[model samples]
Target: MPVRRFYKLYLSPSRKYVKTLKNLLGFVPGNLSLYRLAFRHKSVAQSVKKGVKNSNERLEFLGDAVLGSVVAEVLFKLYPYKDEGFLTELRSKIVNRANLNQLARKLGFEKLIEYDNRMISATRQGSLLGDAFEALVGAVYLDKGYDFTKNFLINHIIKSHIDIHTLEQTETNFKSKLIEWCQRHGKDIIFEHIPNQEGESTKLFTIVVNVDGEVMGLGKEFSKKHAEKLAAEKACEALGI
Candidate 1:
């Protein structure tokens, strides 16, 4: 065994932490600090630079992109005859916040996360696990490169835990889900339609979702109902619904 890998697994001060990560991820992290930062929620994070906390938010953004790309490729190959709409909805269902939270929980990420319980509400905690999962993916990508990260996600996480066929069969009405979430929290929700711009397609509809007067998400589709659903999906993702 290499000296560094040997130390991380057996002799390092963070040996236990390393071992736990290995068991969870199936590999020892090349950069331990990235993994640690990936699970650090803003609620318990201290600022490391000019007004920037060393939280997982940035990593989450990176991971979201990487995850989407990998998933899209897989879905594209998996369903060669599927339409764009079908593939898009399935991708959303797979990467939705609720699904990610459930997956993260099943993978034992809750035990690794760092957060201030008093600062975060129960509803918001649902987003925490999902965020950390994405952040961890970002960390893995940075540490191990794209090929390794893609392989790990597919072979280890997706194949082992996720039921793609089951998700494909499921129906998710994001508009209703978003409305229900708002109602539960006593927040106002609105779907605003934008006027068509010059040279824009007349058949296309544009919709934007606002929650409590803040712009949450926007979507453009050929059908009004489909546009609304797309907007609601974006809103849900924005609010981690």
Candidate 2:
């Protein structure tokens, strides 16, 4: 039996997704439902039945692993002589949330996402795009198999979007840099998150970085991790490190 015909027999409702996915993926997917599910964010997940819930979260988890593996393999082949540390750092740089968010936006995946307007506003949509991109990768892997997805990432994404040379030159680990600076100057580095009393749904964290018993930098962000990074970045600038 033909692949498309076989897919249609099991998933007739996904026929409309075929065209959209073909344009996004550069090839017609064998299983259209996977792609459809990939765009369904948890915030907008509908109960497929009574107990079963459908969302891209599972696909995102799977895709994250698949993407990491593929990227590792690509880096291993691309830099055969580079040590493990160098490769790890490079991989982190490539797959980091900020980089992935930028990549998702660049590929126009943000427009295709199905999310809850109440849960995620337009201004906050940027943070969710990376997860959606990961889910898309998972869907591609499941629908088209590993080799095709690998090629899509390597030939289409890495070749067109990433400039490895520029990435190597960029300094993304501001916290690490600040830590090293503190170590060299014989200073203690500490990060503290201020308590939030706001009753809003989203909690904002204010992080203060202290150096040698003095407050050096302050940063406010939605998450503690980002707040720390922001504080470290400010500290790095303040200390001229």
Candidate 3:
């Protein structure tokens, strides 16, 4: 076994994050800028004043794609005998918001995020964690390269953290739950689809769900399933169903 030497690194919120870079990855970060960028939230537009044009939103986008690709590749190689559908579901379990949020919480990334006072409210707590997690992944990729990113994800995020078996058994299908609730209450739910424009996306949908001919809820999403589900979920809340 190689000798392991411990070194403490100071970070924001007066916290100490142990740096095992020299021991675990054979190098220490020469630039902390990238790490800072990883925890940045777009809500803090002041990064532009500091000459950083883009916020971590772009990084989050890139990280999301990267994470999906890596997770899919790992599942594919690990289960060569499995079918595509199984792989897709497995990938979903691995990359879901809840799973990612759990990872962020476990990593204690809440301390690293830079957010405005408006976003610090209790309701927005989960949003910060999710964004930081994606930003961290993006930061890791930039700082350590693809191989290190892959290994860190598999070793730290996947193998040691996420429990695949429990996730597989858990149901996050809000739409299904909403439908069941409606059925139990003997209420006929109907979703009306209307098209709308959101930025460059030409294809957008607005859903109005009616319960007993009354407009109980409204929602918007990029897909029919998402729109319907959102509307259904809103309806569930409105009716207390």
State the C-alpha lDDT per candidate.
Answer: 0.94, 0.83, 0.70
| Candidate 3: clashing pairs of residues | none
Top candidate, metric lDDT:
1
Tens-place lDDT per residue, model 3, 92-160, is 877866567777877767666777768565545666677767776777788778888898788877887
Tens digits of lDDT, candidate 1, 42-123: 9988888799999999999999999999999999999999999999989988998889999999999999999999998888
Candidate 3, which segments miss by more than 4 Å at Cα?
Answer: 1-30, 47-54, 176-241
For model 1, name the residue pairs that clash: none
Top candidate by TM-score: 1
Candidate 2 yields a Cα-based lDDT of 0.83
TM value for model 3: 0.63
Once fitted onto the true fold, the runs of candidate 1 whose alpha carbons sit more than 4 angstroms away are 179-239
Query: What's the residue-level lDDT of 209 in candidate 3?
Result: 86
Which regions of candidate 2 fall more than 4 Å away from where they truly are?
1-16, 48-52, 121-123, 173-241
TM-score of every model? 0.80, 0.67, 0.63
